[model samples]
Structures are given as structure tokens and as C-alpha cells.
Target: MIDTRRLRTLRAVADHRTVTAAAAALHLTPSAVSQQLVALEHEVGHRLLERDGRGVRLTAVGRILLGHTNEVLAQLERAGADIAAYTAGTAGEVKVASFATAIGLVVAPAMDTLRDKEPGIQVRVLDAEGDQSLTMVLDGAVDVAVAVEYRGAPGEDDLRLFRIPLYSEPFDIVLPRDHPLAAVPDHDGEAAPAPERDAEMPPTPEHDARTAPVDTSPASTHDPRALPVDTPPTPERDTRTLPVDTPPTPERDTRTLPVDTPPTSERGTRTLSVADLSGEIWIGPYPGNPCHDVIALACEHAGFTPEFAHSSDDFSAVVALAAAGAGVAMVPRLALRGTDLSGVVIRPVPGPKRRVFAAVRRGAERHPLLIPLLHALQDAATALRQAPSM
Candidate 1:
């Protein structure tokens, strides 16, 4: 009998194309990954891998086994789902993996809905990028993955996954508050984020000087990755703290759009287009992030490639860099929440929305723990749809 563990190792090897990468994903040493592959080869009586330049490639037989491996793993998921359904495990824990932006965008709201509706069910969330989360879902490392569309991943119609649409959000341009396009009249230089969610930047002379700090919030979450960005508080800025406990609402828009009062001068007439930004220094998501792909493709489609001068996956850092004139950035609307946007301006752009979705193994949606969770996620997405974004 083929060891499923070895089969999973083989699948990881195939997916990452390197022993080092596969081992890192599996939390094993490269020597151990190599040993397992050797053991599996001995058991199957065929050469499963070969060297190519600096990397490894699957042998023909290895590819054939991978096909079976997918089916086998998927069937195992089906069995687990059916068993959970049979046992009526509705109150069991559901593990979720999601990108940081999606966590703020939809998952946090979903968790709230689940908590109110199904008090007994437990939900655990892990922050990961789209590609990493998708792999976690496939490997049974997590019950659900909230992610953006990534290259070379299974699609909606793929036989081994069940996808639930979450939300589609546009990428808004982040420009310095002093940019030429921001010279509009009437409205004061207010940040584009919703008023209730605005974070006060306590004068961080140290944090401010860095074009892009590792983290950018003095009131940062307990997440270890979020370092403190504190500077001495200034007297000129309105130091009043925004209410933290108020729930979000669509009717409470504080943005002073030209339509409300009308722009008097020709200063507010400039419009935004991808082609209009061809020569600007771009601040973008780090490489391998799904948002990076969106920005890169949008620029390419616009007939020019942007030269990214600063990069960060954290939306706060990206906005901070943009605020400091490092470059302009493209950020999803939801991600702008809780970020310091005091020195930034937003000009809405078109198309190329970053669509978020919930994914499970092809047949695992039937799992009792997953049913309420999926419904809760969809419900949260519906609420987000009803809410307005700038």
C-alpha cells in the first residue's frame, strides 16, 4: 500500500519543484524530504524525480502517480466530510486560512456573524497569502481558505474544490496628499478611509522618516509582526480619538466629494486612468502577493510597466510610503481600514477587481462544521456589499 504521507510529500515536491521549498512547507529538513522521496521510490519501483539545471522535475511515472494522488486525497476529504455529516458535528471547530487583507475585508465580519448565529461553533483563523492558504486547504492543514485568484491554482470548475464567492473590491490609487490631483477645493485634506476607522498617527519622527517601516501603527494589533510606529504627538493635528466601538454603516460617509458641494475651480477636474500613471514611481505589494499580480497586469494592459520603488504586503506600510512621497500605491478598499491615511489621497480606478472567495476540498463543503461557516461568510460578504467604499 502506498503511504499517503509519502504521496503528500511527492505532491509538495511537484508543486514547489525543489526539495528545499517542499521541506520548508512541510516543516521538514531537506535531507528528510529527500529520504522520504527515496523511500517512496523504492516502494514504487520507479525513478520519480530528475535534475534539471538547478531544480528537479517529476518523471513521467511521478506525474501519473500525482494524478492518482489528487483523486485519492480528494476522496479522503469526501470521506471525512461525509463522516462529519453523519456524526452531526455542527459545533466542531473550523480552521480558516486567509490573506491579511481578506481577514480585515471579510473574515473578521464572518467570524462575528458565526459567533452570533452559532455560538457553539469555534472558528480559528491564520493569516497567509492566497497561494499559501490555498495550499493549506488542499493539504487539509485548514478547513477553509479565503483567498484571491492566483496563477496555476485550481479554478472554480475544478473537480477537487468547491468555491464560494465572497466579495469583489477595486484597487484604489494612493497618492501623496500634496499631489497635483489632490488640489481640489471645498473639502479639507482628509484621509480617504472611513472616518470611524481612522487611526491617529502619534508623531513618529522616527517612524515617519523611514519611507517604509516594517510596521506602521502605534495602536497596532497584538500580532508579533506589527512593530510599534510611535512618534511624539504634535499639537497642530486634531488629537481627538475616533470611536473604536461604533459598528460600520454606509450612511455615515465623511468624504467631502465634489458632487456634495461642487468643485469651483479647474483644479478638481483631473480624472484617473491606468495610462495616466505610466511614469509615476509605484509603491506596490511585495512579489508573490496576489495584489502584486493585479497591479503588474493592470500596468501591462495599460501599455507600460511601472517601476516599483517600494514594496510591502502590509497595506499600512504601503500607504505610509506613499504618504512620504516614496511612490503611489494601489490598495484594495477594505485593506485601507485601520491604516494610517492622514497624508494620503485616493483617486478611484477601474476594472481589475481583487475578488475574494472561500474554498474547500471539492466535496468537503458538506462537512457539518463547514455549512454554517460558509453561510456566515456569504452573509458577511453581503453586508460588505451593502456597505460603501471609497
Candidate 2:
């Protein structure tokens, strides 16, 4: 085998054209350079240099070897530059895998910044779900991967990957503006009364006692025991043109009213079961996808199996489906922000949360640029968490 050390020495000597000069360049004694050259010639079974007086010149075979040596040296220099560029975080490529939700939310935005900041750096994003992303990262198919863990689902704890929190959003029930619940009065941002119910009327008590028509007189002027005792008979009048002593009847509204609550609410001895959504189709990514697993398990725990009505690698497409009423989908909150989803609603699955991490090849940690990239990701994660809309 041709030794790299010997090749380097030979190439150096060829460039400088003298063993003494090559020794000086390599920080070796002249005797040491001569000895290495002899060993190299023995290994190759060919004389690489011929003595020309006190100096040396390349033999015909040595000339050919020198040409090849120059090519090899050039290749090594290029390789070194590539490594240096990668170390400086100014060049090279990174393969990243994540789900559609995160691709739109975290990865895409971060990539935008990276592109603007480092033109030479290339990032390739793959649309992979949670479990798939993890598998890819672990298997060395991807440099970095983002996966989700539900609020309580089992997941990786300790690994070579650098874990970071991207974002967290509260789940909310989505309803159309014309929904009955939409019309319900809101008191301090909270649901008040059902829209179909009659407007509330505070009770107004009637005057319980009334005194007969009497002349105005000072009550203090007359003593109780001395007042006239005889009382006249009650006056009566026609219903239209006269007054009567009878009490007036209260007026009743004649408009028919709808039931305030659903009949299911009024039923007795019934248990509230998970909604029967067998007829409702579910839409999400594939099985190995993190978001897919989250949605599937959430639905399963909720007593229903989700039907994947549409499968797409594009996360935007998944969200569009949910917004279009095609189906419900579990997605990262960041991706859904500022998106105009007409009827889509976001709800939290009563399950575990997906955790995302930064990963690299085991020995690649020593690379200089890795640390900066790691810090950038950490800072980005913090910024994401603090951002209002993320």
C-alpha cells in the first residue's frame, strides 16, 4: 500500500527539488529525508529519485508518481478546506428531518435565517413524522431530527441528541360564527347563556298592599281611636269604561320558544361516552410520522380510530385539510399561526407531547462549527418559546 506519509514526503521533495530543501520544509534533517525516500522507493519497488551530482532529479517513473502525488495533494487540500468551512459554520450541508407541522413552524423559519446568514451552508429538509424522524436521526440518515412526544407517551430520555423545546399552545374549540354556541353571550371572555334561551329577566315583585283612594290629610292630626269607623262599599265599573277591584292578569309572550339545551342533556341515567366519530374521517401524515402517531393515539384513547382520509408530505396540505373540514389533525401550533383556516379548530390531545432534538454523528461533536450551530438552535428555541404567536 502507498503510505500517505511517504507520499507527502515524496511530493514535498518533488516540489522543492532537493532533499535538503524538503527536509527544511518538513522540519526534518537531510539524513532523515533521504532515509524516508529510500524506504518509500523500497515500498514501491521503484527508484523515485536519481542523483544528479550532489542534488537529485525525478526518474521517469518518479515523474509519473509525482503527477499522481500532485493530484492527491490537491484533493487533500480541497478536503481540508471543506472541513474548515464546516468548522466555521460557513459552508457544508446538513440533512434534517421533521414533520410537516414543524417544517412550517420551526424548521422553515430557522432555515430562512440560516440561508440569509450563511449562503454557503445548505440545509435539506425531509418531511418525516415523529417516529420516522427519530429513526432516521438514530440511523445516521439525518443530521438533525424533530419528533413529538405526547404529554405522557413513552419517549427517548437520554441520547447523544440535543433536546430543545420549540413551542407550546393551548387547545381551543373552534366553531363557526353562525354556530349556536357562537351566538351565546360571552361574559368576560367566558361563555354565558345559550343563544337559543330566552333573555334573562330579573324578578320584579308586585306591590302586595294598596290603600283605597283617600283625601290628603296629615296623619298626625288624627288619633287612631277617634277616626271614623264606617267604611263605604267598593266601587265597580265596566271593563272598558269603568274600574273594578279585581287584580290585573300578567301578559304572556305568545312566541314559541326552542328548548334551551339538547335532549341528550336532559336524559337520565346515561353515561357520557366518547363521541361516535366512525362516520367522521381523520386526515394526517403517515404512520411513522410523529404528528400522525400523536393524533392516532389521542383518537384511540378517545375511543375512536382515525381514518387517514388524505396523506401528504406537505404540512401545509395537512392543515388545509383540517381547515377545509376534511378532517381533524394534530399539528404544531407554530405552523397554524396566521393561517386562515375557515372552520378548522385546534384542540389538545389528552396525551403526551412530542419532543424535538438536535443530533450529530457521535465523533462529529469535535468539529468547530458544531458548537455554534448547537448554540444557534438553543437560542432559537428560547426565542420560539417566548414569542407570543409561536
Instruction: List TM-score per model, in order.
Output: 0.73, 0.44
| Cα RMSD to the true fold for all candidates | 14.7, 33.4
Off by over 4 Å in 1: 28-32, 183-270, 338-342, 388-390
- True lDDT of residue 198, candidate 2: 16
Point out where model 2 deviates above 4 Å.
1-91, 108-127, 130-132, 150-279, 307-329, 345-352
Least accurate 10 contiguous residues by lDDT in model 2 = 207-216
lDDT of 1 by residue, 307-351 (tens): 998878888999889889888888875677667776876655665
> Can you write out model 2's per-residue Cα lDDT over 1-390, one digit (the tens) per residue?
787677778866865678997887677898988888899899889999998887789999998887777556444533553477456655677778876665665677667767676666677889875565654653446766656654333232322233333333321222233333333333344433221111111111321000001112233221211111113222332111111122222111101111111112111101112243344566666766555665566567777787777886455677666556566455543444555544433322222334455544332333334433433454455445433322
Report lDDT (CA) for all predictions: 0.67, 0.48
